[model samples]
Target: MDDTEPVRAEDGCRLWTDDTGHGKPLILCHGGPGLWDMFGAVATVLSARMRVIRWDQRGCGRSERREAEDRELAVLQWSADFADPATARGYAEQLADPWFGINYECNAAITAEERQVWRETELVTACRGLAVPTLIVDGAQDIRPRWAVDSLQEALPSATRVVLPHAGHVPWLEAPDEFRTAVVNFLCPA
Candidate 1:
């Protein structure tokens, strides 16, 4: 796992991937389904001690597009990638044309045959073990359901939650001044 390799998926999509460094495996899945392996900076920092594996998902970057059959199954996740409708237009305008594809970032979760494995992974238990100060800045108008955020707030006992009244998911883009002030205040309290 020291060099980049060209791999082919069972569905026949050609993938470009690589594995480097040593120690715990850290797979940095990019955000958008359309986004490619543009995490060089992140890999550079983590590769010092981590075994980082990166790949361009199907139909993105250098990977070949999915076959017709697989494309049918991919339609839903591809469409639901950005559930926030309010920011969809603005976000699309910000992106270039080559960045639209199926991001299989959560393939394990989405394509798993059994739910018990994921269910048994107690994320809350892991979060409870944290010993450092934590801040969760959320938007009051975020597309993500409130219950989801509430669950995280409940799980993280030491995390302070800041909900900007008029902001959405990308609060910095929506309200830069307020977002900056909140972050600065939290990071460098007076």
Candidate 2:
């Protein structure tokens, strides 16, 4: 946080929750389906304005790492990339399977066969059913040529998308003030 030190969670989840001002229940899902123990200063600022709920999506940081297969099923983890938002896209395509030719920002080295089967995964379905007033934030620069943020917004109708320019991968980390402003706007939305 920009003001205070890191606050650890005791639920075996490496999440930091605080009732900043009793506003909307804002659950901050950082980017990177693989990152857990990181947050940008922007959250620290937003912490003052609303009830901020941020968590490590279960693989990165303190969350116990899962089997490679199970990890692949963790679609919620993708939202953790707030710390490393990107403007470009297509990370999964290049490294993706030749069949579907799916490229992702974070593509773990798997056999070509694995890539083919991975495309049929129901991970997105699980992610789609998440019951939360979620806000998907992304960096202006993503590895995939076409940013997943738009697709994410369309898929998750309840979720809104926010893109920060001059910020890649992690908006809060790259441009603290701008990220903070966005967070405030999303939280306040006046």
Candidate 3:
């Protein structure tokens, strides 16, 4: 186990990160704004050498829940608030609710009222360029839709992306070998 700390953003928002000092801060932003714990096997392997931070966003997993007033959510809101016009909405809406009925989906039952609130959110703006090298992995077949891949490329000019073609929404499951290779390379460079 490592130290978990809360970070205050410029807007007075609180976000948490696990700092293990494995290497540099390799923040792992899980897919679902609701699907919090999506990555594991790879994270376990990476944690052995780098400070991998997996945040549960504002409303899913264990990080924090949406306040009454902030009950709504958006794909952009979930994707670090990227306001860049060049950034693609790609599979944003499509991947938003793939596993809705599954027990794993978070906020699936948001009331009709909450849905309205979620509409108000304007998304934060693409993550302020990461300071350290970043690796973003998307499933080859990831309901990811074609445009989304293009948008991802636009967001992080320096980030490297790996798509597991045979894989679907979850690459770790479909293409474990390729996924593992991508994971290991990102965490421990040659």
Best by TM-score: 1
Question: 51, model 2: CA deviation in Å?
Answer: 69
In the range 103-176, model 2's lDDT, one tens digit per residue, is 44335555565676655336467567876767776777644444456666665647867777656555665666
lDDT of 2: 0.54
Can you tell me which runs of candidate 2 are displaced by over 4 Å?
1-121, 188-190
**Tens digits of lDDT, candidate 3, 1-190:** 4766766656555665555547776877778536675555667778888876776676566555544213235455433322222332433344455523223234465555467654322211343254456687775444436776666565555778887666555555445698899989988989
Model 2 residue 103 CA deviation (Å) reads: 22
Cα RMSDs, all models? 18.1, 21.9, 22.1
lDDT tens digits by residue: candidate 1, 1-190: 4768879887666898877889999987766656799987887788889899988877677777654424543443333333356654554444323445455567666667446544524777877778677888877877678888888777787888888887766666666688888889889999
Where model 1 places Cα greater than 4 Å from the true spot, the runs are 1-88, 95-101, 105-121
Misplaced by over 4 Å in model 3 are: 1-124
Worst 10 residues of 2 by lDDT: 87-96
Of the pair 1 and 2, which is ahead by lDDT?
A: 1
The TM-score obtained by model 2 is 0.35
**Candidates arranged by TM-score, highest first:** 1, 3, 2
What's the TM-score of each model vs. the native? 0.47, 0.35, 0.36
